[model samples]
Target chain A: MLYDVFISPFAEFEFMRRALIGSFALTIGAAPIGVFLMLRRMSLVGDAMAHAILPGAAVGYLISGLSLAAMTAGGLVAGCLVAILAGVVTRNTLLREDASLASFYIISLAAGVTLVSLRGSNIDLLHVLFGSVLALDDDTLLLLAWIATITLLVLAVMFRPLLLECVDPGFLRSVSRGGTVTHLVFLCLVVVNLVGGFHAMGTLLAVGMLMLPAIAARFWCAGVGPMIAAAAFIGALASISGLLVSYHAGLATGPTIILSAGVLYIFSLLVGPHGGLVRQWAPGRHLEA
Target chain B: MTFALRFSDLTLGYERHPAIHHLTGEVPAGDLLAVCGPNGAGKSTLLKGIVGILSPLDGTIERVGVGPREIAYLPQAADIDRSFPVTVYELVSTGLLREAGLFGRIGRGERTRIEDAIAAVGLTGFEGRSIGTLSGGQMQRMLFARLLLQDSPVILLDEPFTAIDDKTTSDLLGLIGRWHSEKRTVIAVLHDFEVVRKHFPRTLLLAREKVAWDATQNALNGENLLKARRMVEAFDTAAHACERAA
Candidate 1:
């Protein structure tokens, strides 16, 4: 029973192994970024940026017929454009960041849908919208691994300024001119992770992989370091379990992984340590008293 | 002492509508000055201008001896998000950013300084605690600990005592006294007239413009105080663009 449930799927099928590796790479690369997004209260912005990349990916698909490099380049450009445009609108106009983001993301999503329909069949559109984790090629797996490596290295180097940015942006501004540069670099990291995630899990559900694990981790840990670690671990566990479920139950692979993460998020919300519902309702909730 | 700051016909505001208009003043390097004003009289605006967060609409603010890094500013409590996940130690250590740039190592000496700052602010054992766990007074103390580590020559404080208890206020006031004794230039925005009268030696009474810049007793006189209120009330809300003469 244990072999069938956990071990045999990976032991028997090459596709399951590839899917598991792809999901693991994505969790390692994107989960910490999600933690920052949650801390900065930009989880919705992450979702918007995810959708904003769709039109660009569609255009790339039209130009190169679903080539990985072209689609990634296109998605990167689209994600960055939306992020920068939203920032510019917030700075120059009366519209807040969320409002501007909302308008731009809707336009991007509509354009993406229209563009995909113009050139591709229903099957192609489904693949683009929902991703194909079980069919990850060697090149795609390598790309995911490289993105994960770069993301972790850059995050480690930029950790201090990024922490300061989330905790006290005003203080960061007072001390150094690096505040704006740090912010821009952070946005670039977000775009890169989103594009990479789109390759593994489709644009629609990529942000789910980024956000759900991070938020779930928030309920488990109080410190930023611990929260990020917890998020990565939860993401990896969800990926493994989700791949197994998809193999056994004949479910769609990408969303199965994200649904697994969602399940963990719900569990964390209910009973995880930091500020879970159960903890809040427990006796002697206030330690000072 | 040298001149720390000189504001020559400085106008500070948003969208060309001046909140502080044509104000000229000089702050001696070590002078402890209190900025007292009625509502909308632009005390906070002046501090923002000094900290280089807000640019002047007209004229220049010349800094004589102090560099940008040599000035520390404490904004109002409303400007900070206290729920951010950071320990008291980590937040206070950020004050050493000037000495230890982005990726520089925090030497033993720097660590000692951070600890000393925490101790000075009465947060010695609370270094490991998250800032979100701190009460209003405790958070304020943590901020002061950061400021103590900053060790800047010029300190601009915007209503530091607001929303804090008397004990916290008095304890922080004692730190301010220590700064004065150490000959650090201190410019503070204060609302309590009694606190100003008792503690502050110099006062700048402001009402959209300078009402009086003199000794605390002279600046807070009944005549000047009444004039300040009247001037602020009568100030035009729909003023035109400032026309600088050739």
Candidate 2:
């Protein structure tokens, strides 16, 4: 029964194995970004950018008829455009960043749904909105792997500046010339990860893989490094359990994965050591100051 | 006297609305200059301008030997997000960024410096604690520890003693006195006239424009103090842009 629940589905189907690897890659790459997003208080901005990528993916779909390359390229462009445009408006006008991003994403989502409905059927829309785990080809797998590698390498290189930018941007700006570049590079990282993730989990559920685990990690870990590590692990666990359960029960894969992450989040909320409900209610001995 | 900073008819503001306008001045090296003014007199704006955070709208600021990185700035405590998840050690260590550069290794020597700086600021026992756990006084001390590690030739402090306990203030002032003795150019925006009179040697009195730039005693004179208040109260924020002779 254990083997049937765990190993049989992956052993029986090449698609299941591909899905597993693809999601593992996505979690490894996207989860750290998720931690930073929460730290920077940009969780909703990440969500807005996720929606902002939709119209671009829709445009790509309309042009190339389900071509991965076209959709990814389109999504990347659209997400970056929205990010840059929102930034520009925030700097040039009285509108704040959250306000600008909200307006642009709302418009992008409407435009994307309209564009998808204009030419395609509901099935195509479902594929775009809620992604197909069964459809990850070798090229898509390579893309995910490459994206994960690049994310890790770039994050390592920019870790110091990025941390400074998050905690004390004014200090970073005064001390070094890398502050603006660090910010732009970070935004690019968000866009690239979202683009890669949208291939497997769809834009809607993709951010769940990014955000839910990160949020859960906050309750478990105190430091940024451990929080990121914890988040990645939680995301990978969710991906695996969700994939196995979906296979056994004939359920949709993407939402199942996100729901699995949601479960972990709720669990962390209840029992995590840092600030969980359990810890809060059950008082511990005070430390000698 | 060798000048550390020279402002040539400087105007600093947000969106072309000048907060401090047509100001011209020079700061001699190793001068402990206090910037005293009424509220909204652009005291913080002037410090920001000197630190290169805000560019001059009308003129230039020539630094003698100090580069942009050579200026250490301590903004108001309210400006920092204390709730951020960082240890005092980690935050204090970042002061070495000028020497470390991006991705540079923090070797044994740097680590020792960080510890010493923390100890100097009376935050040795609190090194491992998160910044959020610190009280306002401890937070200020931590920032001073960071400033110590910064070790810049020019130090700018903005309202450093506000809401701080007297003990912490005195302790921090001792450190500032050490900086002055070490010949670092120290410029601070201070509100307390007594503190200014007692500690600061020189003072620049301002109210959107310069009222007096002289020794602390002269700058804090009753007439100049009253003039600064009147000037600050008389200014109209909604008034049109100043039209003046070139």
Candidate 3:
């Protein structure tokens, strides 16, 4: 029975396998970007960027009649551009960064909803926000694989500048030309990952997945390289565990994966090495002598 | 001897408000310069301006021959943005980014230099320790190690003595003196007039809108000294009034 429900089910149907593959692909793609986003304090932007894509997704559907990959692509490009433009406006104008982000995101969210409403009755706007993991198709799996590969490559190539800029913007500026431009590019890369993640993980889960592992891994160490590795491991593990839980319990895979990540975050909060509650609460572990 | 820093009519500030007006100064080779001022007198602002932290408003302020490759800056103790997850070793190693003299991999010679720099700052055993796990003095030492790795001919320090114990202060000043003996120029924005007289041969007093005074304590003993005293008293009175209002 266990073989039939768990092991043999993979052999019987393609959708179940596709669902797992799609989610894994998405995780691999978005995990590293998620880690860095948390470091940059750009996690909220990641979440907002994910939501920012919904109206674009709806608009793409109305134009293309529900080609998931094409619609998602449209949504991603629109969201990324909006994020960049908002950042630019914030820097150029008198408004503070977060305030500008709030202004742009609110308007984008409103516009996206209006676009979705105008698109037609066939499309469900809720599906864009929550994501439809069960509806994973071959094309989406391929797209996920492609995005994951691109993200890995981009990070590898620009690792030095990106990491340096994140850690020491002034230092990078002192060394490199137009350090601000380099920072913007990094932000854009993070936005791309979030938009790509929206395909299988959905907006909320996608953003949650980005931050949870990184924050949890802060309990492990204070080194950037190690922190990122730990975060990626936690993310991959949470994805697998979440998928398994959903497979067994008939729950929403995206939300379940998010819950798994949430568990890790909580664990890190209480048991993390840097500032864990357990360490603080232990008899001999308190900071003061 | 090369001019370590030569500022010609440099005007610098934040946003639109100018702090150090179109002023000029030169710190020749191997000299220890004490930049003095009352509260809000733009001493720190002048140091930052020299290091290109704040953009120059008008006129030319050149570091003479020093490019980005040749200057090390030790920021104010309170001004450091320290929310990073880095170790002392990591912080020092960043200094070698300019010093390594190459790319891709850091060579053995650079690594040896980094170790020596860390040792010089009395943080030999703490190189592997996380920066967040440091005391205020240790953090300053770690920053000094970073500056050492930069190995620049010119070092600009902004109020590096605040909150430090006197022992550490002397230890650090001794190190700065050693650099001067090695023919490296050190320019520091300082508050201690006593130390200024003892260690620094030349001192420049600033009052935001003016140079205020630029000479030794002997010059300060004359009319220049009385004017500087007035400036200092003005600053004290302003602080007391603000406190009462608060």
The candidate maximizing TM-score is 2
* lDDT per model vs. reference: 0.87, 0.89, 0.72
TM-score of each: 0.94, 0.96, 0.87
For each candidate, what is chain B's TM-score? Answer: 0.94, 0.95, 0.84
Predicted complexes: DockQ each = 0.55, 0.65, 0.24
Q: For candidate 1, what is the DockQ?
A: 0.55
Deviation from native of the Cα of residue A193 in model 3, angstroms: 1.2
Better of 2 and 3 by DockQ: 2
Please provide, for model 3 over A14-77, each residue's C-alpha lDDT reduced to its tens digit, 9 standing for 90 to 100. Answer: 7767877776776676667776777777778776776676667777777777677667777777
Model 3: DockQ score: 0.24
Q: List the residue pairs that clash in candidate 2.
A: none
State the iRMSD of every prediction, in order shown: 1.8, 1.5, 3.5
- Sort order, TM-score high to low: 2, 1, 3
DockQ-based CAPRI category assigned to the predicted complex of candidate 2: medium
lDDT (10s digit) by residue, model 1, range A16-92? 89988988899998889999999999988788888888888888888887799988988988888888777778756
Tens digits of per-residue lDDT, candidate 1, B94-210, equal 888776776789989889999999998888999898888899899888888888888898998999998999998999999999999999999999999999888999999999889
Q: Residue A269 in model 1: shift from native, Å?
A: 1.8
lDDT (0-100) at residue B16 of candidate 2? Answer: 82
CA displacement after TM-score superposition, residue A272 of candidate 1 (Å): 0.8
Off by over 4 Å in 3: A1-6, A89-95, A117-122, A164-178, A268-274, A283-289, B68-70, B77-83, B99-103, B209-215, B229-246
